[model samples]
Target: MEKRFNKIVTLFAGLGLLVSCVSENKIEETFGVKKLVDNCVEKTILTINGLTDADSLPRNILQGQAEWNKVGIHDWTSGFWPGILWYAYEASGDSTILSNARKFTEPLYGVLDVPVDNHDLGFMLNCSFGNGYRLTKDSAYHDFLLVAADSLATLFNPKVGTILSWPAMGEKMGWPHNTIIDNMINLELLFWASKNGGSHDLYDMAVRHAETCMNTLVRPDYTIYHVAVFDTINGHFIKGVTHQGYSDNSMWTRGQGWGIYGYTMVYRETGNEKFLDLAEKLADKFIERLPEDGIPYWDFDCPSIPNAPKDASAAAVAASAMLELSTFMKSEELTTKYKDAAVSLLTRLSSDDYSSKDKNKAMLMHSTGHYPNGSEIDASIIYADYYYIEALTRLKKINEGRRL
Candidate 1:
């Protein structure tokens, strides 16, 4: 049903383009969308090729070490690097980029068949195989995504009303049921799976998990908790806490970005007005608190304030989400506001101060990953680049008279 609906929308979009006589070049000239995308692709190719002569690609560039770090397929972030390569190929039609994307994506096949904990299977599979299927319409890619969606659904707890994020590895910190804001990004895989002929149960699990997140993690002011613990046995809410933020009550910048992205996605899949409202509220809160550069600090409540490290990754994620959210909005005022805010944020990320000087390194800098653990602080993270490219693609689609 969803597929049929999308086909109709596509038909109408094509008719509209024909009627308006809007060529791709005209749209690109008006928005400079293709120019920005071309720049990103050039930077990505240079950075990726420069990272290694070996088969492995860099997960991230460690600025202090002046080297790139690689991770295995099971790693939470393994999918994004290849996913970026696919995007590059899509934009440029470069045969070398396509070959590299295929090579990098081949290693990720293990993720579909293996058992893994953590809620990032969506990130792992969706970015790689998800994009692969979208572009090539390969049956193998579709089958793998189905397998991965089933694998991800195994973590969902009916009692807890959410997918368990972390396993009970540590007695002090790990609970039987723990959900994180990052899990929200994974739900897209579930929704796609169900709509594409997977189980209705997977779709139901996603909706329930989203509702539980909104109830437990989202605060009145639109800030979000990094973690939500539940008593799985009794189906009771235990506590809200922070593992990566400044403190338990403080707002982690990336968590807020996840909220904005996640809820906007829910609105997209479900057409729920309340979810759209929540996404817009979170976007406003995030934009309202931005520093002068339109980027965000590592944590909203960080004591360093003006001295805190900027998280260009969070800004990228939120900007991308806002762009998509704007497409669903009915009010012209809200749409323009969100669109302008996303443009401002992306402009900051593309500026000389935030963008890497050397084309052979990470593109956008100043990302904070696991700050409380003292890992990847103020460095360029892979997922940041992924979302930045995604945002640009979305904007380009919008300008070309298409849906986001």
Candidate 2:
């Protein structure tokens, strides 16, 4: 659901948000919160129980495939499956879910046992063990997350002021120092560790990486480049390009979502107004480009319009970011604006067009994963389901006057 080319003004004029044409929107309605979350999660468990275990993690399933395309512990997405389980346990308090989550989580220790090869340790460990520690307060999980943070820190290039997203591939791709916008989300693991027991250098490294991304990756209008190439020689800017987006110039919807979520979280952890400002700007740009449905297409600038694959995964990511962002706004109007936007997104995601419902064992569908590679086109991706459940849980808590 991207704003089609050249129709931006007309679309805004003819159509208003679900909240209204202007002013704050009401958020107290009973939108079947418990039923929706429970059913989606129940379907998730039923669908995944048979496919996933400590041995393999489900990534995505294409149409006509009877089973999900599974991966081993080395897969970057492995932690999301367990992270989803931890969120499920937090929401339902189901002991079975808890047991299954632990079953899937313990095997990931191999990540810390090896030298970090990629910038996804945060995704691999934090999503799984980080949430586990937050929910269960398991001392082992806490200790593991601290090690994960240190491992992730080893990837930081002090010269570039950003973590190397793909260390092994950088040499082959001729990008000596490359940082993807998705790297922003991983900073949370470092932030958490610095406050817990790790050195404050972890926190400093995260902020530096974010600052590098803010300067190099974010475009003038705040639409993000999927990847930014930095000069390794002097740690100077080289050029902005894309590997997963439509082109070197187009706005990747998911990249923008990562920036939004990243900076909001940075602000939350650091109490920095500059980060909050950047988060607000990123959110505004995202909202400006969103189509009527609030979900975004794979790329806002993709030549294809109605035919471009919709990334429900991007919507889930932004929805969760906005919910937390709304809490930090000083202006009542802006806070209402974000929370209302989040509600609109969640409502649409719950609808038949997006929600897998009885059709599949996943929570949501129609996610565009690596469209340029023609991989997992319009499939149910694991990260989509992970962030979708996380957003739903956050909404449920917010509605009940509980802390997110």
Q: Model 2, 207: alpha-carbon shift in Å?
A: 0.9
| lDDT for each residue of candidate 1 in 137-198, tens digit (9 for 90 to 100) | 88988998998999999888898899889875326576658899999999999999998879
lDDT of residue 295 for candidate 2: 80
- Candidate 2 residue lDDT tens string, 1-404: 35575588767766666336231224334466777778766965785567645768888877665456788989899999899999888878989889888988999998777778889988889999988999889999999888889888888999999999998767788888889999999999999999999999999999999988999999988889888888888999888889889999999999999999999999999998999999999999989999976788999999988789999999999999999999899999999899888878888888999988666667788998898999988998989989888888888888767888
The C-alpha local distance difference test score for the whole of candidate 2 amounts to 0.87
TM-score of each: 0.91, 0.91
Candidate 1 stretches with Cα past 4 Å from truth are 1-31, 51-55, 64-67, 169-174
lDDT for position 133 in model 1: 86
Highest TM-score: give the candidate number.
Answer: 2
How many clashing residue pairs, candidate 1? 0
